[model samples]
Target: MKKTLLALLCAFITSAASAQSVSTVVHPEWSKNAAIYEANIRQYSPEGSFKKFEEYLPELKKMGVGVIWIMPINPIGKVNRKGTLGSYYAVADYTAVNPEFGTPEDFHHLVNAIHAQGMKVIIDWVANHTAWDHPWAKTHPEYYIHDAKGNFVPPVPDWADVIKLDYGNAQLRSEMINALKYWISNYDLDGFRCDVAAMVPTDFWNDARTQLDQIKPVFMLAEATERDLQEHAFDMTYGWQFKDVWGDIAKGKKNAADLVAYLHGEEAGYNPNSYRMLHTSNHDLNSWEGTEFDRLGDAVETFLVLSNTLKGMPLLYQGQEAGNTKALDFFERDPIIWKDHPYRALYTKLFHLKQTNHALWNGLAGGQPQLIKTADDDHIFAFSRSKDNDQIIGIFNLSDKARKFSSNDPILQGSFTDPLTGQSGQSASAPIELKAWEYRLLVK
Candidate 1:
């Protein structure tokens, strides 16, 4: 009987350990309260050089930015390349910097400058495919996926300039991992924003995360929204559904009720410890879809506030603060016209609030959002978050018309200050009015 019991106990222990998720994996200590800024080197300045970008580091740091995610720096394949300079995603070599951006030494200097400014850096990685002329096509023909005719093929019909990689090939997986490690070993990069991470196998990402952690705890951001990816391989995933819902609201097709439902659905579906990246604009959205102003109209800042204060890590894409109002030319040189804008100050204030308020921290480090009941739930969205002694309440008029609402929730009836307008006072169940597309963020 003792022998049988011992064996059963051992089996149970192994089962529990095996069930541990990638979400529980080790993360760098620095990421606890971090916010990410996506830097598109090409569109950031006219020169599109790393050295020129390095000059903007101090200003970004002053804005309370913590992590900088630079777009791909690898050389692009000339064969079958698209556009005037080729897509940055069509990587020709994994280990070298794009000469158009600058030399490898110049990149190193830029990374050092970012570090010197007390910020972390992550590079965009395109592991799902490579440029058609990538040496692997000739040196390791077996490493790529083949069409029905047994010829190398692109992953999708539209991505003709790049060919897909076959993760099924063990050697290819090994080589891909080696290339990932090479960047960390050589450039001292903090982590990666994996492009189309869902196209690659989850096991490969799990293994890569494990191996990369052996060198140093790394932050991984997946461009996809697979929950399993966050379980062990990624620290964060794209909040695609959130963006979709917001877009619908901006278009007057959805309302605050829909947002509340989404919040509940997200809470029930995603792991409590998983971080979601919230953003109003990104490379794909700004270049392919449309700029936030074009999509959201006069409600642009309203949506931006929702992204920042929501229960996730906020993402500020390149030139978003300056309100780059046009869809940038994806395949040609289109530089952002930098100027002093209210959006800059807005982000600076919101980012500082995110860093200091434990109630607003990322993932498990922060508070769970408690939806505050209010009259006119269809137009007025209200919620509060509390962690320890810190508390934050956010109320927004998501509709195009002005909204009037009354809230009797005890959590909101107290002395509070509005971070945006600097108004402070005790609250009651009295009716409150908000202008069209206006929001209030109260803190105690």
Candidate 2:
């Protein structure tokens, strides 16, 4: 009887532990079919103010953007600031809005306006570090890491504008959590996009998430790609690997098989419910690297389609829709040159399909990509994701040369129409011919 009771107790303990591990965080319902847009408020318009940026909310909503991830709006550090206008990541204050952007009241109205448009807003949070001038350096010196000489140090050598924050201090953790809570409580923000999230202790984020959720369900996006971050803290992480592989394919180094392998690897590595943010270009990529047009060449639209339909949430950076060729200045006000570009229409079609089609929904709410066998698997990539009555089939010609391919996969047999072009009557009976850097997104 003693032996049996001991065995039962151990099993019960193990089961409880498993349940606790799996139930760390619950995602917000609105995020399931949402496509996130990174709004560079400072560079969004000529004025680069909240009032100016707010004028385009209707256009964004119509463009099918579900969530708006605003870049840092806090006052930038001036002591060791970079360029005339310092980097957005070098934050001096956590709670106050940057006067350059607008008054705190203006920001409040902007957030309310975004919510009113049936969309969500999240602010970029630089948790790992702060500007050298941040008050914490004087009042709460213990909150930061110190050098042997007792001077403050930057997290990275090149990041001289900011000082590294130390999560080892319990008081610092509590204070940071309080600051995070302040935004949600006051502004009613949907969530935060934590910058360099992995640099901060995972336990700190876990605690933060728990406390934030107590206020309201929030969507957390981590800039890092660490898988463990998703298990507890973040709802989504950057799909840097996918972006790299896509770039390689465009450069003629990696092919379709390599792309498929990366997708398979992602499936095995991340939980089905974990959201990966896939994008062709972002603030960093566009500024540091070249524009998507420069890197992907003519294949920019082709990769954009894959990023939208593949098993993850899609991210659209500001200016991408306008086919903005110039990499806007990161530290200065370089407004996007908006024009009636064709990419805008393409993005609208893809984003709307993602919202309506259950197959392309984000995380576990959506179906997984099943590879559809094609004759030219090397140069052509084809796959289908279906949920209930909704289905989307994506076929891409990854090479610079046109390719002809045929697929006998049962999923490809049904009649389908191209969502972007509205052309119908495409079927698996005839071979498909695609031009170089062209893609066909068929929906049924």
Model 2 regions lying over 4 Å from their true place: 1-24
On residues 190-296, what C-alpha lDDT tens digit does candidate 2 reach at each position? Answer: 99999999999999999999999999999999999887788888999999998899999999999997886666544446777889899999999999998999999
| Candidate 2 clashing pairs, residues 3+ apart or interchain | none
Give the Å shift of residue 234 in candidate 2: 0.8
**What Cα-based lDDT does every candidate model obtain?**
0.88, 0.90
Worst 10 residues of 2 by lDDT: 15-24
* Candidate maximizing lDDT: 2
- Candidate 1 residues 107-138, lDDT tens each? 99999999999999999999999999999999
Per-model RMSD to reference: 7.7, 7.4
